[model samples]
Target chain A: MSNLIKLNGHTASVAEDEWLLVSLPASEAEERKQAGKVVLFKLTGENTVTNKQIANTVIPTTGKVIVPLSVFIARKAVLQARISKGEIGVWLSTHEVLEHLIKSQPDLNGLPMMAIHVERFADGRIFSLGTLLRTRYGYQNELRAFGDVLRDQLYFLKRSGFTSFQIRADRSAEDALASLNDFSVPYQGAVDEPQPVFQRYNRAV
Target chain B: MYKYDEIDQTIVDERVAQYRDQTRRFLAGELTEDEFRPLRLQNGLYIQRYAPMLRIAVPYGMLSSKQLHKLGDIASKYDKGYGHFSTRQNLQLNWPTVEDSPDILAELATVEMHAIQTSGNCIRNITTDQFAGVAPDEIIDPRAIAEILRQWSTFHPEFALLPRKFKIAVSGTKHDRAVVQAHDIGMEFYTDAQGKMAIRVWVGGGLGRTPILGSVIREHLEWQHALTYCEAIIRVYNLHGRRDNIYKARVKILVKALGIDEFKKQVEAEWAHLKGAPNTITETELTRVSQHFETMPYETLPRHDAGFDTTLVSNPAFAAWVKRCVHPHKMAGYRAVTLSLKPHGKAPGDASSKQMWAVADLAEQYSFAELRVSHEQNLILADVKLADLFALWEKARANGLATPNIGLLTDIICCPGGDFCSLANAKSIPIAEAIQMQFDNLDYLHDIGDIEINISGCMNGCGHHSVGHIGILGVDKDSSEWYQVSIGGKQGNDASLGTVIGPSFAAEEMPRVIQKLIDVYIAERMPEEHFIDTVRRLGIAPFKANVYTKEGAAA
Candidate 1:
């Protein structure tokens, strides 16, 4: 059975009955996950023993395991373990990491998932990166935005193809949600609304 | 002159209500100052050094008698009984309280005016020739297109939070009286070989810390594609323009960084998606807007008025005023008169409430109840009959609007510097006043002939010092005010940025330095040559030597 598990204040669905094994902090994984939610393992460093453990614990079914890109790149055996189990998802902090992954793992084109970390001041850069990633690299997974999300900037953030935002805990979620509808009309193209206002108006006319 | 219909009226009315609510929330502590600053600025309210300065947009500088009277009334009621006409052809009330801005805006809306997109990062008030429809050299009336652009840019959701402020100017005449080259986007209208009206579009031109003339991105764009093309350009800018640095965020910087060719290619790529869109203006809509700017009901008269000729010969003062202030009109007996605001020892553009009322009365009595605010911070009665020159001059003189120094040394273009603006490095009005005092003689000014002295308090170039024939910019050195002089700049058809001469001068020494520069021009000027031509021929070398010489500096 699949169940929702919280990791570092973010919620993700995990398949425990399947062969998914998440590589994150063990304490956070244990406290946030229900019994038999998923396999939780700590990635202290890149070693053959951890990879062997990961390889032995896998069950053959379609599932996803979330792990940082550093651990995935360090241990090729661990990557093979995740690949043999099901799909592999990686958390990214910068464009450098994404570039390195693309160059290193060409066969993981349709197999790998991407989640981008965004800063408040780096919206323009992240937006541009998201555009190139989708249009040029054929990245189809739902892109996630993390870190210091403000309500006023949600409209622009969402327009840039970020499907999920890890909003700050102190902020009001309702206010942030309402901000998505603050502007009834937009003047340019975006992921949520691809047609510019002029095109829509012309079609109506 | 485009009358507001129900839709237009609703747009402005809703904006006013929205701003009023914003003000309420701000006062109740629901919004922080940081949150409320951009909202207020978008509505044309700026918290200045002394008080909140509210800028009221006078679209294309056109005004009716009733609107003029309403402005005067607002000046008396909400301001300090006066208003300053800005170089952008808008009016600024320098003493309004921030809380009172909503009330003032509501009052403005009653007269079919609203202060939308005046001061924020979005598109600003569209400007054009003061004598737009009536200029003799006009090939196509630009006001209609300007009005269309105004409507399209207002309350634009995506562009509201652009990287920086944007400005657009249009010119209908070949002479470039609208200073198109100094705007972010400059559109010049012309008839192509097919007898169809087309536009030449220039992008990335602006005056600020870095002054660059706009480069032509589209040499010939059909009139139908005007709005859509503009949308493409702005969208490209909004998505890709630099946001990390405020100083490097203007479209000019982006255009320069990308090169005009690459920028044009990018704009073309973006425009490919927007071509033939609904925003493309139709002939019916064009006619609907153009009809509002049709020629006034001008009475037919003889080409040569005997009384006008006689008045020129009989009254010296009237002739001088006519010579300096009157501009040619397309009609035979009609003339456009510039009412100079740069009288001796006064702020360049300040007009008292009584003077505003007097101009309104004059407009109602003559000139078909119309007035214009020129980009040089002067008022224009654009359709005055030639026969009424003497009477209009007398009334204008009485109202302190007739300085007879139009296009002369004393007719300065100055920004309200440290006195009002919080961003100013030094005071500018006193510099203008000192120079005006030194050259107060009208005959001497007329002899100097067409010397433009533009002054700005800072490098923001609000006074357009970059294009002044003799530009003066204020600089701060260790917290003390100093002035720098630049020579040989000109605005108009062949716009050029001025070249700054050597080191800075003290405030008290500016008048002396300017006098020395004028002396150099007098000594070297050929017969019938204007000040700008003389400076252009001689270059800044002679003037620099003359000003820096010990004897010249002491004088």
Candidate 2:
């Protein structure tokens, strides 16, 4: 089980096996794991990290570390090149991962990716980031973001880009599972690809 | 006096609504301070030392009397009843709360004005000679070109986000009073033999950490291609200019980094792609903009004023006022009178509500209801007749506007330094006041003659300290305020940057330092040489030695 803490308002989660990690894309996580440095990132609780910790330079680029968002804006080219080569590991925030691909694609050919929801707080930028990444940038990967992610945001986030989530350890898995049935239809284009909104209906038929 | 057409009106109204929304979001906490910082800056709102300062663009230093009255009303209602005219030909209100800005902007919009792109990392208000259309030597009104750029660049999709702020100045007069050499892009308006006016464009001149004079890139570009050329330059700069270091982000640095030739080539390539496109200006649009000023009725009268003679004979003070405050007009009977806001010891460009009303009244009564704010920190009634000179001077003197120090040593161009500005190193207003008190003697100043003592609070050069005949820059050393003095900088016609004289001086010691330099000029000058001409003749070595010498041999 992971513990979550709100940091700079973004819900951040920490796992016992991890030294310190903010859920980022494959590239960011790869960079961190490769760096293998003891990382300290801001979070709402003991386990979760927010988008604010996306590019923070708490420790030098020794090995696994969390970076700040500003770092990505500055070193997009270099970071993109590294990500393309698959030499680094990254944890993508719910939405940030998609913007990167849409804005800059160093290796769009076939790159494995994953997403994380930092917290269950009131802030929704990460969810928007997720939806935009999936719907706008067309990222089809394991999307997980649900701390306090209400059924609506979860459904939207799922339809948009996210596909997987870590629910509250205390809550019943059945109740949590039951809330996921709030939405009837996937509206239109999503993280998967540019397909018709009624493609799910087509699948059902 | 470029009137707003449908497009111009549309852009301004759209900008006002945009700023209103930004303000609402900022007030409602929907936008964070970091997110709203650039948005407010794009609307020309600065959180200054005391309060929020709103800088309203007075495009090319031109304002209609109605516009001036609107500024006065905004200052009175929303602010502390006064406005400071900035060196950029803009008006700044220093005491407005965050909430009041939306209303103030909305008010400004009614007059076809909004503070868009004035303080942001985008193209700033395109400034031209204050005497643009009225100046005798102008080929055509540079305001024509300025208005074209105004329309084309306002909320320009691509240029809205640039690496750094860009400033373009145009000079139509032979004498470059517009400080063309110190702008990011300086264009001189000239006519070819076939009588078609064109722009002689120079790029990459600025004064901040690294002061540079622009090198000419395009000698003769047609007026229609002016906006496109400017867009090309800005686009190239936006993509290539450095963002890592704030100091290196200005286009001047980019020009320096790339070298002028390569920069010009890049700009030429960019220009090639952009020119003759959909954005090319139309002659009909130019005609529409030019119509705003084309039809001012002029009554041909004799050159001399008999009343001016009688007043000169009767009042020596009036004659002295004429000598200093008045200038020869392009029209025979008319004279351009400067309403000096810099009294014996006051802030350089500040005018109270009363003073503003007085100038408005005088403009209406004497000068065709038009006024000009000169780059020299004074207001000009550009078309006043010589016959009404005495009445105007008397009215101005009564209102404390007739300082009789136009272009003299005391007519110092100063910026609001540490007292108000957030980016100042030390207080510049006090420094100017101190110098003004030291040089109170009119005859002494007249003897010194035609000297520009410009002071900047910091290195931003808002005070135009670089081009002053005697420039003073405020620097802090060990917590004490000190000034760096420079000699021999001139702006008009032949522009040269001033050379610093050795070490800096304590704030109190600056006046003596200036006196010493003047003493050297007085001793070395041939018959009737001014400070700058003497510096030209004798070189800076003598002035440097005399200024920095242990003993001036006389004190």
Candidate 3:
């Protein structure tokens, strides 16, 4: 039971007291195998890995099994049971994975900080993702957005629930800081204020 | 006329300040162009072909004399000393600079107006009958509800970035003067069994590349649930509407794809969560909004006026103008007069700065300081005294606002086509001009009687060609502009899209095509039949055969 278990041409082992991260590769699954006490999996592209295959390979052991957030959300019930049993963790790469997970699982709270890449800000997904993570899912972990973050979008990002932002190399933090107060009044619900403008009006009046 | 309360005033002022800051940031290079485009559009500033066009909202088509003067001042100061009243009942300044937009908005705010939500993928300016409160057939005034919707949708957060623009039209009568069936959301106000006002809701009606008449989703919805029901409909469209194709993004496509019953089911399911929400209108709030549009005080007088009767017979032009332009008002001793903006040789709905000032003065003198912009691209003095018809006609005639061709063949509704619009496929104004010149004889026009000749530069249908009795759409064929003629479309209560007559014709041949259609009408019409009636009586066969004939084609 303590030795490496080989199933369907994939190899993985359970550590005694540490978490394991697994990386599922298409053709070189044997070459990229980690022999460390903690193993985490980074599944990329269309692979043949199923929820049952990952579960069978990782379960019946004591160590923590970390998987990609997208796979975790897709197999939430099976992974959530493992997470509650202190045998699983999630690794996230994009905001969409977190948004879907939080929206589908309301009881999910306190996600571990994950690397967030902000590729486009004009589509308003960055703001909405942050809003859903904080307001709807009760996410308490630090949320970060990186890549081409402008000073103007910072105002919306912070209000929507971003704790930290990786500004571009050329932009200054002071310029970004000044934009947080761009609009004194916002018309929507956000992490900091959960009431819409109309409800706020009713309360004030 | 709904006056702005303190809250409304504060909201407009705050929006001005907010936009001023946004403009400053963009000018200083802090905000990128992509990030600033939607914000600027929400403020009604569009980067057109030649210059920036700023559209100002005229809520439910109502304007005060003071507001009109403010518009005139802005037009003269910032634009090319003129403005165009659009078919959506808004005003567009065709030649304003982007930098001066904030100042223009500030000027508008002073007169209880702003450019909020005039353009963008948001709920646009709410439209209603130009004769909302004064029409004899009206059950209740729709302006109160239109005003409420205006406030409710302003800067609505969830609906700000919809897949496409949304439009709402309210009608208080069965006549459908506001073209309610052609809007994104059409509300028909009526009295229920308990004598309380209720609304019949219609959804997904729009005219774009696809022309669809809306279907009734709810037969009788209580009046208080208007806002919440609208919210449910919008949220469903915003979240599920197509974002892949720009042309297929309107709610009409969504409704069509899901089918009306399934769409209504989804909307009702969503409404289940928002029905009793705080946004629901209360009696107090209803009364508060309704008080703003209460009937004005009028002097006690007989229904008939001898002075009005004498003026009608004394001058033939005045008699013709009264017959065509004057509309019956619900109130005794009062009438609604449409000041025609469709004078010959001029672009329809384009008002010069001097004409704006003149109309403002006329409204102040004869219509209790109120005026309206009709969806027909004309202006209305809704509360004019019957005895003041002759005096008002003289003033309107001198200012080029009296064409006496309302509801007639030459009262054309045309879009600012390839000349100013970047999206036009061909030129529409010149086509309208040619047709008006060809039918310049008022006697000939009056003999033809009550024909709506709507022209659009493209299939966007800004001129509402789909509902025009004689619809002319400009198409680009082989890089040359060609006109496609359609006939027999009727608007009012029996709204129907026009049928294309035949193959396309050259721009120079539009007048001949229209003449041939009118000649067919004259030849085939029954006694006392209108143009549309004749076209409906005999199908498009006669007209199509006559227009494509060798002699008709060579004319």
lDDT of 2 by residue, B377-456 (tens): 78888888788888899899999999889988889999999999988888899888888988899888888888889999
Off by over 4 Å in 1: A1-205, B552-555
lDDT of 1 by residue, B447-518 (tens): 899889999999999999999999999999999999999988888888889999999999999999999999
Which wins on lDDT, candidate 1 or candidate 2?
Answer: 1
Q: Candidate 3: which stretches are off by over 4 Å?
A: A1-69, A75-106, A109-205, B552-555
Residues B345-417, candidate 3, lDDT per residue (tens digit)? 7899999999999999999999989999999999999998888888999999999998999999888999998
Question: How many Å off is the CA of B18 in candidate 3?
Answer: 2.6
Better of 2 and 3 by lDDT: 3
On TM-score, the stronger of 1 and 3 is: 3
The model with the greater DockQ, 1 or 2, is 1
Q: What is the lDDT of residue B48 in candidate 2?
A: 92
- Choose the strongest candidate by TM-score: 3
* List of clashing residue pairs for candidate 3: A20-A39, A21-A39, A21-A40, A22-A40, A22-A41, A23-A41
